[model samples]
Target: MSEPFDPARWRPAAFLPERDVRDPALIFAIAVLCFLACLTALGVIAGDRAAHGWSGQLKGEATVIVRARGGETPDAAAARAAETLAGVPGVSEARALEKEKAYDLIRPWLGDVTDLEDLPVPRLVAVSLDRKRPATATVLQEALKAQGVDAVVDDHQIWIKDIRRAAGVVRLSGASIFLLIALAAAAVVAFATRAGLAARRDVVQVLHLAGAEDNQIANLFELRFARVAAISGALGAIAAALTGALLRLIGGGAGITPALPIAWLDLLAVLPCPLLAAIVAVVAARLTARRLIQDL
Candidate 1:
């Protein structure tokens, strides 16, 4: 009588007895890929946060520069411009900036200046616009002109656009890198599968002669590679996560805040890298096995 199937003995690994089925090179390649994938995901998350934060902080805000002209002092013109801006319908607040602060703003370009008083530095007025009733740069400039203050208003919209475009480029580059890594990983897994199949060709021929189906043989290799990929990928992902946490801690110790804020929920992006690696391995191995088996 035929023996009944035993659930305990039905593990997929049992079908593949060759030690070469688990390729160390494949595992190492998969681990490296997973590590890079984790980093890419983190970069995308950070870039997105930084872009949104910059936009939120700079939108609807402007700086008004009052130049001294026609016997008018810069400081007096700045004060008048601030008063005029405050009375504008969409302007929430306008404050005249101190000369010392204005000097500091230009210090990076001009270096330390002991005689900043002699420099023809324009006086600055910081303007805040109400979100519900946003003011246009043209209106603010016209209002200052009406008050006899020769001024230029910079809304910083162009700078914000450039920042967002830079973030988008960063995100696109990271995604491209991630995609290349994934494709390379799949290629590695396929190569390893073929190598294993070559090593066990005799066993495969014997099994076929003994009535084993092609899918049965393919399953053996798939399961073996899937397990190795899962283990190696998990190790790499864990290492990457620990490294990221360590960096955050070190940055905090150095009193450097990250440009992009990290929250607990960001872990979701990092946690799936290993699983994606394993799925790639399994699919590649299965496809390679089936194709090779068909040729046999």
Candidate 2:
């Protein structure tokens, strides 16, 4: 009987360390916070896509209006101008607007646009461009001027500028929200680390006096914290998914619409957020343990 082979001297204490972060309540709280942060991030991503979709779908097409030169019978000049534009190299298809359709467009602003039809609307040609469209506004304008009608190209680029500006603002706002969430997570981790250190103060002191190395003590804290955070993160991500699904169901039932919907794809994209939160918590715990262990 070789002294009964006591293994306590060589092996570290199993689950007897100061921080045994296997608590269910703490884990649940951490998970919930992570899920909320991810939800906000998903909203930001969806907003960005909607802005780009609106801008891209409407860009590159322009409207051309051929106005009569005011003195002569306007029909011949308008037709000649239309014929000239249709033959231009960049112009793919040019169609003169029917009077009814033109009147309908002005109805919103002028009210009873049928009365305004007699007021010269200038023969409007909606121009479609081919792949290798010429830099044709100036060329077309000059050509139309030669044809005795004043022509103007309305390229619709002003809306593009506005859309880009709006998108930039949305991106900046999303960045701000992400930063705030990170700060909140850091704060939570800091608070949790401090509480954990306080709880295990006596255990840490006993271990320090027992000749256990500082690294070993720190390792115990890191392990406990990491395990707790991983469990919490997983729970939080799952809860978040459930909540998002519920909301989507409710919205669908009501036939509600948003510029962007909360889809499973976005939810999947954000699934890693909780895991990142856990990593942040573990790092915070490690740093806290190192400092406190040194003080002891």
Candidate 3:
């Protein structure tokens, strides 16, 4: 036989049940948003790295188009320009590309041309610059002028500026996307809190009349939903990190694409997601619960 219940030993049932039937749906939706946010953060980091890499490569080199003059052969003019550019203080090395290299550059436009030597094709010179103190276009051009070699220098200044602008755009776009996802997650939690309060109106009324303070009622939902969001965040963050790792493994050291190389370190960007999710949930749940509870 069961013992009789004593008033002193009786404990009240929780205002909200330990688990709700609708929580799984809420968790799934929030988790998907968190996953997308993490991926966006990782992509932003990788894209920034790629843009910097391309810019650095362009900055450290220049090109020259050599035009023959005053009875000089194309090859002789190119070699003279290369030697002149090599003597510049900031230039590391300068070499004239072979005729075949020039043919490959123009073959697409000119179609098949077996007797390419007859046409007055200008020669090209590739210049390597010193990393610590690279040569500028004006300096290079002056050096060629001093040697009486007619050539044009392309220092890639225009290309580098464009790449930097692209990187800034990528960063701005990523931040906007992340903010949108966070707002979406907060909205979901707020709606869920409101629905939960509406469904348990009678219980909330009884608790309020029984001397439970407004903050106490709000705190209960705050802690409960915060825990749920924290767990969901972990799930989503783990999934995103795993996807990034797979790309890193598949691409090996080079990464999935040259433009966006996923690094193992980039996966760490998702680490703070759980805490952020909890904070958003706490604010959302507390505000929603208090507003609806006060009306009752």
Candidate 4:
């Protein structure tokens, strides 16, 4: 097993500060900003997918639309097709569509169920295939033809493919956005660390003149910067979470489906982000200090 990282004992005081445990406010800020952005993006992507994918579960029930072709009666054709499908292998249940039920399906767009009487609503059969090795279109097609019903199969795979592609795009976009956010976070840390170092330059100069090692001076800055980063990161994360929750509540509706819940796991999963920000600040500080010392 890989050993855990011990920041204190891992390097000299120049790289690892003794007083680093104070607070990491700035680091926390950057991390929380990134985490919130990531979570929001994820939620948006998830909600879109869930709504599109699970809207109507057609997989569990196969629909056979018997066209009113030739001199064949639509009702008769549907009944014959339903009987054939029910007898087919791997078919658990089959039923011919009742006129009231068929009209109700079109009632959404056509207004009243009575309005669909003139519409050529073809004979319909609802079939439930056994879970194991469900019947295929080829088998069902042949059986329907034998029963004198012109039937077509719609498995909804084409639309599902399009949705999957959209999901891929969403995930890719989210990744890219988060990457940019992280870069921004690193830049912020670098800037803050430089500012901190500049403010303490006189103290550092005095320490150096007093025969204190470069490592000792570096340690003080690292500790201070790390603390600032940590605290800031935590605050940012909390704020992000609260904002997300509020938005979720605002958008909550029976008709609306969210991608995923903004749970503790996502929040907790990125808790180490603040530490990473602090590390960036510390490194930036170290590099600036080295440059300053060299120029002297």
Clashes of each: 0, 1, 0, 24
Residue-level lDDT tens digits of model 2 in 1-296: 56676666676557445445446666666766776666667667666766666666445456776667757434555566668778877777667766566567767878864476467766567766564544356766776777767778776678779988988888788768967875786567557766776688887888888998878877777777777777777776777677767766776832114555566666685677656766776687778877777887
Candidate 1 weakest ten by summed lDDT: 253-262
Residue-wise lDDT of candidate 3 within 146-199, one digit each (tens)? 999989999989998998788778778877877787677667666666676677
TM-scores of all predicted structures:
0.78, 0.76, 0.87, 0.66
Alpha-carbon local distance difference test for all models = 0.76, 0.68, 0.86, 0.67
Q: State the local distance difference test value for candidate 3.
A: 0.86
Query: Compared with the true structure, what per-residue lDDT tens digits does model 1 show for residues 1-296?
Result: 87998998886655567455356776777778677777666666766776677776677689998898887777888888899999998999999999887899899999986888888899899999987777989999888888778889999989979878877887787778777876776666567666766777776777777888888877777787778778767877887777666655666732114575554455566677667666766787777777766767
Query: Cα lDDT of model 4 overall?
Result: 0.67
TM-score of candidate 1 on Cα atoms, chains taken together? 0.78
Could you tell me which residue pairs clash in candidate 1? Answer: none
Best by lDDT: 3
Q: List candidate 1 stretches off by more than 4 Å.
A: 1-13, 18-25, 51-57, 68-73, 87-92, 103-121, 129-134, 146-148, 253-264
lDDT of 4 by residue, 96-133 (tens): 98967777776787776445656778767888877666
Number of the predicted model whose TM-score against the real structure is largest:
3
lDDT value for candidate 1? 0.76
